[model samples]
Target: SLSLSLYRAAMKGPGLFSDIGKKGRDLLEKDYNYDQKLTVSTRTASGLGLTTNAVKKGGLYVGDITTQFKYGETTIDVKVDTESKVTSTVTRAELFPCTKAMTTFKNSDLNYGKLEVQYFHDHASVTGAVTLKQPPNVDISGTLGSHGIVFGAEAGFDSVLGTFTKYNAGLSLKKSQTIVSLQLVDKGDMLRASYVHHLDGKQTSAAVGEITRK
Candidate 1:
């Protein structure tokens, strides 16, 4: 009955506690608000750079400007440079419904861009990403399980080189606070094995071994 009265009071204004109710509602609405920042740096003869950043609820936007204002030898020698980027991320219900997923998109004026999508449930997750540019690239990676045995792999293609520039796979076995991992890269051209054991709160022991192609 108390909560019902409070809800009714919050819904209807022009009362003694209406201002408190209005402030509470406003705070809840702006719970995930964002902020903006600006930074400026100048170096003798090097140039001056100003960076601006905005972090939204689930996204980030950045811009940069560089110019030689004080070091230019002549009026025609002065140069100004500018860069801008916008990145955003959405998760699960924010982008869609029901699915446990997250997606990120980023774009920059410097011919750089990226999109990544991931789906995670329980202790397993899968991620896929694409880079946009002259040499566009795509990568896929995933991990499974948290205890006992966990494994993940990542592979990518480089359009510029017309080859797979990224290739890595790893498996980890964990029990208690001890873990052993084996990883390979470049189709077995490189191999690494490591073991890590956690002692007390301030101590740990680890060993690593590696083998490389000749």
Candidate 2:
């Protein structure tokens, strides 16, 4: 379930800063799901969407349901798991020209609430997030790029401990049909390099490779 957790965490923001070198990363990392979870999703013209996922565990099917609604620049999502715990998220985009904001609440725990914001420019992007609790954790990330190159870094801080919890950096180059990226992740405990090349103009076919060291 680590992959699913990571995917949910990554979905918290608008993805401006985190998307800096995402092409190569996606090419190298996505689509390796071995969990064998069965998922079905549908959307209606009324801006309502529903998704259900079921996975076999302990010879039984465990599942979750997620409902989403979109109206204008705002989106709302609500999810319920087999245990009947509810989580809700609201996202607003373009609140101030290229800015996005989101808030999430889990179950009935006030401490489980969180807020996130992101802003994007032609050559730069930034994101910030904080937990709505005493002694909360805070996160910040930024990226700068122009003319087919980008550099980005992200950090997390524990307000109560007054220490950094995480830090990572990445760089990427994108040409007409190829993308190369290098990332230092896991609080700088791992290094990775990835390359992706499109085989044709439509980008329907491609080659991808990656190397990592811990």
Each candidate's root-mean-square deviation in Å? Answer: 20.7, 5.4
The collision pairs in model 2 are: none
lDDT of 2 at 203: 98
Query: Residue by residue across 104-142, what tens digits does model 1's lDDT show?
Result: 344534455565555555566666767756566887777
> What's the count of clashing pairs in each model shown?
0, 0
Per-model C-alpha lDDT, please?
0.47, 0.76
TM-score of each: 0.46, 0.78
Task: Give candidate 2's whole-model lDDT.
Answer: 0.76
Candidate 1: TM-score? 0.46
Which residue segments of model 2 deviate by more than 4 Å? Answer: 1-15, 34-37, 94-98
- The 10-residue segment of model 1 with minimum total lDDT is 1-10
Q: Name the top lDDT candidate.
A: 2
| Best of the candidates, TM-score | 2
